[model samples]
Target: MKYPSTSTRSAIAALLCCTSLVPGQTAAQDAVQLPDIILDSGAVADDQTIVAEAISAGGKLTGDILDIPASVSVVTSAEIERRNAKDIEEVLNYTAGVVTNSYGADDRFDYFSIRGFNAYTYRDGLTLGENFGGIREEPFAFERVEVFKGANSAVFGVSDPGGSVNYVTKTPRGARFGSAYGTIGSFDTKEVGLDFGDVLNADGSLSYRFTGLVRDGEREYPFSRNDEVFVMGGLSWQPTERTELTFVLDHLDRDDVPGSGGFPIGYDFDRSDTFFGEPDFNFRGTERTTATLIGRHDFGNGLSFGGTARFSDGNDDFGYAYVSGQTATDANRSFFASDSAEKVAIADVHLAYDPQFGSFASSTLLGFEASRSESSNKRYFGPAPSVSIDDPVYTGAPSSVPLFADGETEVSGRAVYLQETLDWNDRVIASFGVRQDWIDITERDLLAGSSATNDISATTGRFGLTYKATTDLSLFASYAQSVVPAGTGVEPENGEQFEIGAKWRPLGGGTLLSAAAYDLSKTNITRTNPVTNLPEPIGEIRVRGIDLEAKAELGAFDLTASYSYIDPEITENGTAGNEGNQPARVPNHIGSIWANYTLEGDGARGDMTFGLGARYSGSYFFDDANVAGESDSYVAIDAAYTYALSDNTELAINATNLFDEKHVAFGGFYADFYSPGREVQATIRRSW
Candidate 1:
């Protein structure tokens, strides 16, 4: 028999008997004495960011949104709760400078464009790796989403200059709380979810949280289903008041998935509810698991260290077909069935230094990051099936189809970076950072029995300054560089951006107004690589744009509005008939407005709230080539109502696309896609 060592046992005993708050208790802990700009992790108070006034994506360090020199947008947990978001894309549908749900009601993945390009999706500061087509994430598991705009390779290592999305997850809180809810909604949706947290030991050193969800839902297309199970557990141990460590594990199992539908151009939008695939043949499933660990230590000196690491593995299988070719009423279905797997490991560590010298103060950060990713997929093609487009006929699935060898990819990356921020008398702030990245990728083509390796290195940096004109206003300017590696032998894609912006709180606290204008250009434009699933340089593109936003919380009313204008041009490309044309699906104009009002009674039990919103997306080309005609612009409306049944219970109803407008969301991939007409959901929740 083996037991813990004497040193380990003594340490455990000391932690168990230390002066502390109870497990899951968020009280009586000593906070690191760093300035808000450094945003020491231990300084984050429980429930302080429900409205998300502070963000961590802009600079890899949590800080006030107003302090960051870039364009940033945050979708808070409170906001997500009120909206009852169905997917990640829907959660950011109304945010400025971005477009979501690009393919309408596609339930397989969340598609979105930020600042005219696809941005990286990260959770807790780590990428989930290129998808193997099987994994799905639940929106309810997140606490907030931060959108950091412009080139940020200096801080993040590798990325598209457009921006990045960082999802802050829900972890163990310092206090005890729990909630459970049941929901019923359009498309035969039924779901139940629970979240609970509490202290784990007599001393407040150990805390734990558990969140779970089970859902059965259907897609816009008839006969397509989406069934899921999600479970997450988190533990936080504060062995000492000034130091802490947290661990989290997340698992998602999708027993069934909604099929992806494809139709001909100019197809009738009214037929969105129609299913064109054989029910038994169109099937998909995904099983995934991920683990994350975060640790922070305040040396009690002016130095602190923060480290995070994550690992993920997933498996996916799909058996579905889409319209390959069609003429008038006859359609040719391309049958495809595939199996895929993905694994990823990523970690980041940083040391921060803060010092105050009279009127001048400074914060410096030195960091290292590394990651490894692998993916493989094998696919089979069966005999094509034919069905009438006007009136599709259902038939049984065909038998044995010959399989073909596919490809696999392995990617590894390592980076080192440093940043410094100087605060001059609290009036002028200057920020600067630089990073160097080394990447290696290997791809294997099974059928050809061939493999290739590519090694690349790049240096990126950013510089910015902010000047506080008054207590209520600030002005900023920034310049940044980014790079993305591509296929073997192809030079990596590179981009640069210059931006100027202003933030104002004219009405004082709780009110904010901001505006920004930027010029962004990229050489060696990139496309998704088949084997590695990473962007590979292809052409060149440029974009100039402006973003405007306003948000206010005045007494019983809360409101938010946004508008953006962009002009995109494909400056250089092969003779593919796309040069000098606007990039496909890049809208020129987008706007939205939303507001809510609360009516209160003498007691908290009788409170009532009403909310409404509207969004507009301008027309754009369906393909990079100008040959494809332009699409039609569309407007959407959403609404919600909530009633507090009691202190710990509530009833809520929400609707999206309230008017049931049948319109084309976007078009590409040789097929037309339409937005879902409308959806309504009702939920009853209890909390204590």
Candidate 2:
């Protein structure tokens, strides 16, 4: 039987051939042996195994998502379709060891924390951060979402502890055409999307795809609205089996209607207090444009290379308004406004090689990346004119506020890294890699008459070992390190991590379980005063945690569950001891479970699948001092169903936050905001 082309097949075959003919080899070793047909053994049919192989191949060939040698999670297109996810946050929430928070009134400014780390958003493995909010791109154009947990300085040079999120763009495939979809839900929400793919040339070597979305919605909260439109086009050229090139152009325009500023911590739940502030505070109204070009080449002899270049420009105008007072009598209100614009450019190249030696095989990758970003933000502060309880008016003309004159910041970085994986006798594997980065930052405080520029560099490394105890069970342990330079106007810090884990599959291809324990520390962190030029030590932070996950499929039922416990603290500080007293907002307990069942199998016109899921988070503090009160723990449940109408048509219904649990995922020192309320949406789609 013929099997799919795999790097290990050739390497192993060559090794066995050489070993059998050795002069000292016995008759048993000299005998000819047949190559193992991995595909026929039902091993290559599993999604997990296929994904793992893809990752290995990618690491050895181009060092994309496959070379990181870290804990990685991939949400496939089928999973996204099954869940009917609408945004990046929705998809990431289902991933293990990830936490997401949305605080703005409209919940458009989504913030993600992964394994107690932060990630700089990327599209197609390229940086997509902006000046105002770092990142706010929609996920409608992505084919899948890949999350790399732990420190990823090797891939993204200067980043946060939250790891990184890369959205793989959807490109033209072999298909010809597709239909549009529309969804409607609570808060007068409406969303429409269209996708089309086709071969433009008779030879099937040239193809194009166009995808676009327009959405207008309102949150369950009072006085919040969102409007956004996105369009992207992709062109692909596959002139030969050995090479491929693709280009994409994307654009986004978003507007937030006027609304109440942030919600009050204590009285926000009372629907009657909706009129606490002016109803004209707009958070973000912006336009972003991006273009990317990617190319890949394969040299047949277990060697491949790829490169990508991207550019983005953005502009945004936002306002902040709030009321301060005890009761209905003496409350005073104020308004603050800011306008920002930014430009960014990035380029990256990757190369991979696979070679065989006596009784050993190795896959190696080398990569380099560089990025430049510039941004300017101007602030305006003024008093809000008082009017009737129902009516509020603008009082002062907008002008640059004193002591804060149009702050301008610029940041740039270059990085290079190498990764290698070694396999011995197809049972034991060892991986090693390292990354080096150079970062530069410039900040100008116009009002303070001061300017600062700082340059810093660092190197990080990773090592791991995996032993195949059995065909179905594998034990693995890994340690990785990461470093992040301080943002503009701040100095850099040093961070290190230690981890060990084991993976077990008791039922071979049927059930998979994994457990891990990790400890991470960071020192010499830089903290700067917003008004002063002095920099202070933020102290040392230590985080230790354990993660447990299980996935299984029995008959027609599928199950996935995960649990995590974290103890993060500040070990040393100028103000306090023991690692800053349990780093604020880092919850100690997090868990999630999801299950699905399918009905109708024997020659039915359609099939139906139903899914149920739940997420739980423990109490967390809100401030660094740990003096602020703790946010209450909460549990949320969701359900979804899909029915196939025909070979090319289907319908799906998704309900999120079924219990409408009132909880706060995150909050600032001064105020807190509630997460989205219950929402339900239905969609119909067709493909040809």
Which lDDT tens digits does candidate 1 get at residues 210-234?
Answer: 7777776766676666677777889
Task: Estimate TM-scores for all models.
Answer: 0.90, 0.85
Worst 10 residues of 2 by lDDT: 45-54
Query: What is the TM-score (0 to 1) of candidate 1?
Result: 0.90
Q: Which residue runs of candidate 1 sit more than 4 Å off their true CA positions?
A: 1-50, 129-135, 256-260, 401-405, 506-508, 527-538, 603-605
Steric collisions counted per model: 8, 9
